[model samples]
Target: MNTVTRAHLCEAVYQEVGLSRNESSALVESILAEICDELVAGHTVKISSFGTFSVREKGGRIGRNPKTGEEVPIAPRRVLSFRASHVLKDHINHAPASGDNDADGTR
Candidate 1:
């Protein structure tokens, strides 16, 4: 699988919206920063047709270490989680498959 980075998103925005490269990059960064700020404030961020990002609190617990068979104390921390929206799930589930499958295994 290929990874999509901020640069890729900026390029896409530049192409689709006719923005300059730097402008697209700044736009992407601004949106990301907003989302992060909300999440850090313990608020959920809901993006239409995409997903929801939320921060979850995890309680401290005892955990066992593998290989050493030692008991370890797990520190409690906040974790970020994402839940795909129904629209996103539907889109992903119904996406058309790339025509990369052939009986001869050649595209």
Candidate 2:
């Protein structure tokens, strides 16, 4: 399994867009910062063909402690969640599996 990082995104942008490494990094950072800022401001962000990001508020609840069989209170708080768009889901579902070749036998 592999995880994509900010550095990977920057490198991709630099290669595909012919931007300097620093500029690519800055662009990625700026876009992420804007998303974060909007979420922090209680706004939902929807990117076409990608997904939607929003904050959800969960109510406080009583949870049990398994070790001592004690009950504990869970605080209410906001959580960030993502719902992938149908376009993204379809793309992922139709994508080639790991180690599999494409239709043209290309990786």
Candidate 3:
């Protein structure tokens, strides 16, 4: 989802948990900042029911250009990966029970 939608959800969470909008926004910002910091530091972050973010090192390799088909050298780089937690994966793979349902439970 987009940032706006995420913000909206966070706002709802705050409302449910009895926090002000500003406090909720600050909480969201803090968590996001922590994720950014972890990625920047080349560390792996795993949220129990959400996902994981990891930095991987890539070795330099030769690749073929699509158009020219010429050999190109690719430099090594760091990459981040996210693996969904069991709860998140269950949501993704879950099917409705066919009573009354909505995508992503937005209903």
Off by over 4 Å in 2: 97-107
lDDT (Cα, tens digit) per residue for candidate 1, span 1-107: 54668987887788889889999999999999999999999999999989999899999999999989999999999999999999999987884577435423331
Ranking by lDDT: 2, 1, 3
Candidate 2: tens digits of C-alpha lDDT, residues 1-107: 55668987887788789889999999999999999999999899999999999999999999999999899999998999999999999988895666454333321
Candidate 2 residue 62 Cα shift, in angstroms, is 0.9
Which prediction has more favorable TM-score, 1 or 3? Answer: 1
Estimate the overall C-alpha local distance difference test score of candidate 2. Answer: 0.88
Superior by lDDT: candidate 1 or candidate 3: 1
**Candidate with better lDDT, 2 vs 3:** 2
Query: After TM-score superposition, what is the CA distance of residue 20 in candidate 2 from its true location, in Å?
Result: 0.9
How many backbone clashes can be found in candidate 1? 0
Candidate 2: lDDT of 98?
68
TM-score for each predicted model, relative to the true structure: 0.84, 0.84, 0.73
Q: State the lDDT at 36 in candidate 2.
A: 100
**Candidate 3 displacement at residue 76 in angstroms:** 0.7
